[model samples]
Target: MKLTLTPSTIHPPFGRYAHGVKATGSGILVASGQLGIGPDGTVPADAEAQARICMDSIVAILREGGLTLGDVVRLNAFVTHHDYFAPYMAVRDEYLADLRQKPASTLVVAAGLSRPEFLVEIEATAVF
Candidate 1:
């Protein structure tokens, strides 16, 4: 897959992330932004829990897309606070541990998201 990263109109871009991303390919999967929908039948409503669940959801989508984590070519993480970085990153590493190929990534911090219960949101690009 081919991808393009764009700047966020609200927050100026720094070294960390692009404001947006665009992609085009022969055949591609635009995985929906996965929420931390857990077994309890409700979203955990915690930042770290949600982030981990989000990544898990991403993994599921990867499989559904006929790809694996190693196929991920780019990643974008959205969070409300930088303080959550360590724990969130730990969960990310746990899932991406054996990724044969690592994707380029960016983490975004915002004042708020679509929902207050959501602590983090993730969007990604994968080439398979």
Candidate 2:
């Protein structure tokens, strides 16, 4: 089982995510950061579209480990600029909307990603 924690001592999360998640299980899966580039080597120009692709890639990685989004406990996301935060969060919220317990999440604006064309990158940790 997993528990989402938000201590009253601290300010509430600014987005649709928990401050922390406690998972008690035997296995833990950590997926590498996924870039916005598609399998065909195409990168979308829109930040929202790139964010969606990043989330989709993370979903596929979780599935490969025989787990679903429900098993995810944490997510770390990076964007090339502050302007991309809203678009990235929109996509993240959409994909995780159905989850009963939101995962712990962090989004950072970095100077750049591995690729110049990539706008967003996402990584996930799951417990099962």
Who wins the lDDT comparison?
Answer: 2
Q: TM-score winner among the candidates?
A: 2
User: Residue 55's C-alpha lDDT in candidate 2?
Assistant: 81
lDDT tens digits by residue: candidate 1, 55-110? 87666666655667787777788788888677678788887888776778888888
Q: Give a tens-digit lDDT track for model 2, residues 1-128.
A: 65554444333434576534445465777666777766666788989998887787767666655678898899999999889999999999999999999999999989998668888988888888
Per-model CA lDDT versus the true structure: 0.64, 0.77
Off by over 4 Å in 1: 1-27, 39-41
lDDT at position 60, candidate 2:
66
